[model samples]
Target: MSVRVLLVDDNPVVRIGLRSLLELDDRMDVCGEASSGQEAVAVASRERPDVVLLDVRMPGSGGLDVLPALTQLSRVLMLTYSDEPAVVSEALRGGATGYLVHGAFQSDELAMAIIDTAEGRPRLSPAAASVLLQGFHGGGTAVAEAPATHDRAEPTVVPEVVKQHALSRREVEICRLLVAGMSNGDIARRLFIEEKTVKNHLNRIFAKLGAANRAEAIATCLGTRRGA
Candidate 1:
């Protein structure tokens, strides 16, 4: 079955371009188009798309303004030009399933992202990931934070949930970095390992935690920490 997608952007050209790009993939169907947040909500309600590609800015009622409603209808991916950490954080907090900045991904990647989001695996472009990481390091976002303690140098203790999954030490370390919003490449470099190694570890981590993706794994760890 083709994945139903709703395209919401103010620019007609952008909408057309997106439609063209997505149509190339046999797995995607552009179910509807909306030029503003209000129209997006109305169209989404009627079409019941599986995924919504929403722009951050429009003439009125920007993506964020209508996000809560849209998210209720379908999984939303913020496809916009803005990579501002604040905007990214706001969108994620507003229930966006994924965030992809324009120019950060190609058509194929976009198609894959839609599929991933539809399958409940959140996708983030490199720029979006960096923005999230920045917000996390600045201590102003939902990305996991080290437990509050007197010593700033104290290592982030792995959440009990992670341990319950019986993750290896290296897997726990990768999980910690992932919750911090670090990309696979960043985690690989941070741990002085090849990117492929990080991918392998992540696959193992996901299997152990029963997580579908990075976001789910992070959410599991963070939920445990927040409740502690």
Candidate 2:
């Protein structure tokens, strides 16, 4: 399936460059473009792109400020040059599907990020995750910067930590499997992904739960204190 993208950045040159690169990939399409936050929202409401690639810093009402509005229409991926942890944390809290550093990323990276965002996957770049993890662990200037998830009926399948860490739906699924005592290989087989991917999810899960290891993670998710 082709992913429809709404490119939102103040710079026309950047939008043109991004459109050029995105067109190189056959699975994605640039459906629209916007140069400001309000314009982005209006375009998104009309075009309803599967993913919105938004700049973090834009003139007049920054991208993060418009995030919630756009999210109501489609998933959003933050595209920015700022590597500041605080900025990354704020973007995540505003409900970004992923955060990408424009310069550090390549064409393929952007393509995959779009694909993942369209598929309801959280594409936290390693750099972004490092900063977010610090926030989760009280190291950030604003501690526990958990992202605000979209409004939906709270499912019975969701765990308590859902509100606190904004774990991806896949992450919550993996957490359920962990509670069932599934090993990494077992999770990989069940999820039909590589064990390496499961490991990566576990790392994110543990960090979000502020767990030192599996036991703590499970305990934390269940809202129980460790037996030790």
Candidate 3:
């Protein structure tokens, strides 16, 4: 199916340019446009596009302001020029499907981003991720900056599976770790199992849970809890 897209940006030129660029791909179509965060939310609610490319900074309501409201309408892909990792993290925490660098992306890259976000993954621009890594793990040492404002790619969604049956105890453990962003290697290490064995167990867990990925699996488990 063609990916229906909504363009949300204050700049008329940028919006028109983006619409023109994305239209080149036969799989993409601009179903709507909004000049502000609030308008974007309204248009999104009505259009119910497959993906939304939103600018981070806008008057009255910024990307953060309208993000949650758009959640019910469509997957949101942050297409902005902002380089702040804190902003990125907050957007993810607030339910953004993906993040991309508007200055650096090509039409094809944006198309791929739409596909990725539609599937439910968090994609960050490489440069943006590097900034985040530096801020989180590089200590006080500053990393070399990229000379140019380059385009970046981010995921729209991470594939998750559903639980079709009751989960086993071990499956619950895995689900918990997965929700916490623990990698398979980490989960295996904690469980005293080989990583390959963990993969096998996860396979069964997905099938039994009817989930496409760890997030869905975890959400299923959480739904059965007292306050989930």
User: Top model by lDDT, which number?
Assistant: 1
lDDT of each: 0.78, 0.77, 0.70
**Which regions of candidate 3 deviate over 4 angstroms?**
131-228
Q: Write the per-residue lDDT of candidate 1 for residues 1-228, one digit (tens) a residue.
A: 999999999999999999998998899999999999999999999999999999986765778889999988999988998665546776776788889988888777999999988987778877667755654322122556432221233235356775678777887788777766565655667789977688889888888777876657777766653322
In model 1, pairs of residues that clash are none
Give me the overall lDDT of model 1.
0.78
Least well predicted 10-residue stretch by lDDT in candidate 3: 148-157
Please, what are the lDDT tens digits per residue for candidate 2 over residues 191-212?
Answer: 8997778888999998888888
Model 1 segments more than 4 A misplaced = 134-228
lDDT at residue 129 of model 3 (Cα atoms): 62
Model 3, 1-228: lDDT tens digits are: 898999999999999999898888898889999999999988988889988998876765777778888877888888887655545555665567777886676667878888787777656677556645653222112234422211322211122323336666677667666555454555677789977678888899778766776556666655542222
Model 2 pairs in collision: none
Clashes of 1: 0
Q: What's the best-to-worst order under TM-score?
A: 1, 2, 3
Model 2 Cα shift for residue 157 (angstroms)? 49
